[model samples]
Target: MPANTANVVAEYKDPADFYNLINSDEFSNDVGQMLKSFATARTVPGIYETDVSPKEVFTSPVSEIFRIKIHGDQAKETTARAEWENFTKTLNGKKVLSGVSINLEERLFLGIVGWESFEVSRLLNPFHWARKLKFTGSRKIP
Candidate 1:
């Protein structure tokens, strides 16, 4: 480290935000138990809010699934059309249960993500672009 040396840069958008629900000791404990349960199932686990809604569940259909509750200025300009296009292109062969967008009431403009009906159990992973990522959630609508 020298004068005028280059350093890592991280621009904080919302530094004053913290969630008591997820930050408390009780939450940590509960999360630990949840992880244990998940592990027992021997399946992958998605990040928090990874898949907000399950796909193709007409029993109790949901329009959207959100990962992060907050977002920056760039994501605000997006629309459901963009999502629809992506699903039609990317997840074309897969079964799509529903696709809807909802407001997180946070900083971000786009926090909603949808789940493909055939990929409902795939919520444990969402970043897999090509092919399949073996992951799913344990919530069956029916």
Candidate 2:
């Protein structure tokens, strides 16, 4: 079997907002910074800008999705929200998708870079200098 790559997600107040952010250079810059923050704060193997590429679709029957769960206190969540808002503040446009779900409980966040095959996924996500094991122990690929 081929190895699997992971993905990340974020919640938005409107679909238009999501699209606008995703399409902007500011989004790229902010996301690039966020990924670096994750690597530094979480001490996960750092991923570079060259290592990431956006995709239109992240889920499919054949896809192996990597799920990550963060257990933190409300203070941490509040901090995260502040950081996220700072990144998103660059979005100067209006909301496009109305009635978008903004509830914190209903949202998920995934960070992913699609790989052509499982082998590539495994190779890139090296842990202990071994390509056979998943790199980030916190993430589960099911």
* Candidate number with greatest TM-score: 2
TM-score of each: 0.26, 0.27
* Global lDDT of each candidate: 0.33, 0.35
Residue pairs whose backbone atoms clash in candidate 1 = 46-124, 56-97, 63-100, 65-113, 71-108, 121-135, 121-136, 122-135, 122-136
Q: What TM-score should be assigned to candidate 1?
A: 0.26
List model 1 lDDT by residue over 58-128, tens digit each.
22222233322224434422443344346446543443332222324333222233344424535534434
Superposed by TM-score, candidate 1 places the C-alpha of residue 38 at a distance from the truth, in angstroms, of 1.9
Alpha-carbon RMSD of each model: 14.8, 17.0
- For candidate 2, write residues 10-125 as lDDT tens digits: 54434567667657898669876776644434422222121122233233222233222223345533443444344334323211111111223422232233334456455544
Cα displacement (angstroms), candidate 1, residue 66, comes to: 9.9
Candidate 1: C-alpha lDDT: 0.33
